[model samples]
Target: MAVLMEKKFPVEAGAYETAGEVSTTIKRTLKQLGVSAEVLRHVSVACYEVELNLVIHSDGGALTLQVEPDKVTLISQDVGPGIPDIGKAMTEGFSTANEEARTLGFGAGMGLPNMKRNATEFDIQSEVGVGTTITMSFALDMKG
Candidate 1:
């Protein structure tokens, strides 16, 4: 599929000061491009979830947005301390978030599950000591 637009934002670990900015920018960009409200809503949720995951879990990473004719894709790639258990992590209430994250009310173990639930297609890959990458795609409603 040909990409109509693409943007990447770098996320710093534990950077609570600027946590949700990237996802907000993504949503706004998509909205400015005249994307359907349904698709924009899904992308917003999944984008926020994945961006928070990068901040709370991974060392550091980049979140990328790609807009295609048929779909919008969000890719998050992080550096280290990758997820050890994919199955457990996928559980709705399973969280490895530290006390700091908990105090901020950010990590409720719903990030991954919510991202998956909001996207039309979701895929995650991780390797111990390497990193984790999550890719989520939302199919655009092109029937205007």
Candidate 2:
């Protein structure tokens, strides 16, 4: 599991103005690396969802992209205030988004659910006072 490439992008909470930049950059980077379209699409969607969660939730954190020979991994780690109930958070249409986020048409409570749906594998860890971390992996088809 040697990493071929890696990049970390810092995300600020409530930074709606720069919300999708990190994910878009990740998508472009993967495209330039010749990743398969299916994998790219999955990564792109999951990546965007995680990025948005960072902006809308958490205090601030980093989104990391790791590219290996057979898979792409996205690690999103954010500072407090953390999720107390990960199960509830993962449920579709369940969100703690504030009115501002809703006004921007950003938080539909679909972030975690959508990320899990798009990624090949998904895991989330959160501490009420510590922070939250989400890891998602998309398997690449290198056979082509």
**CA lDDT of each prediction against the hidden true structure:** 0.90, 0.91
Which residue runs of candidate 1 sit more than 4 Å off their true CA positions? Answer: 142-144
| Collision count for each candidate, in order | 0, 0
Candidate 2 structure quality by residue, lDDT tens digits, 1-144: 999999999999999988999999999999999998878888998998899889998899999999999899999999889998889999999999988889989778999999998988899999988999999998897221
Model 2 stretches with alpha carbons more than 4 Å out: 142-144
- What is the TM-score of each predicted model, taking all chains together? 0.95, 0.95
- Model 1 scores worst on lDDT over the 10 consecutive residues at 135-144
Cand. 2 TM to true fold: 0.95
Model 2 whole-model lDDT (C-alpha atoms): 0.91
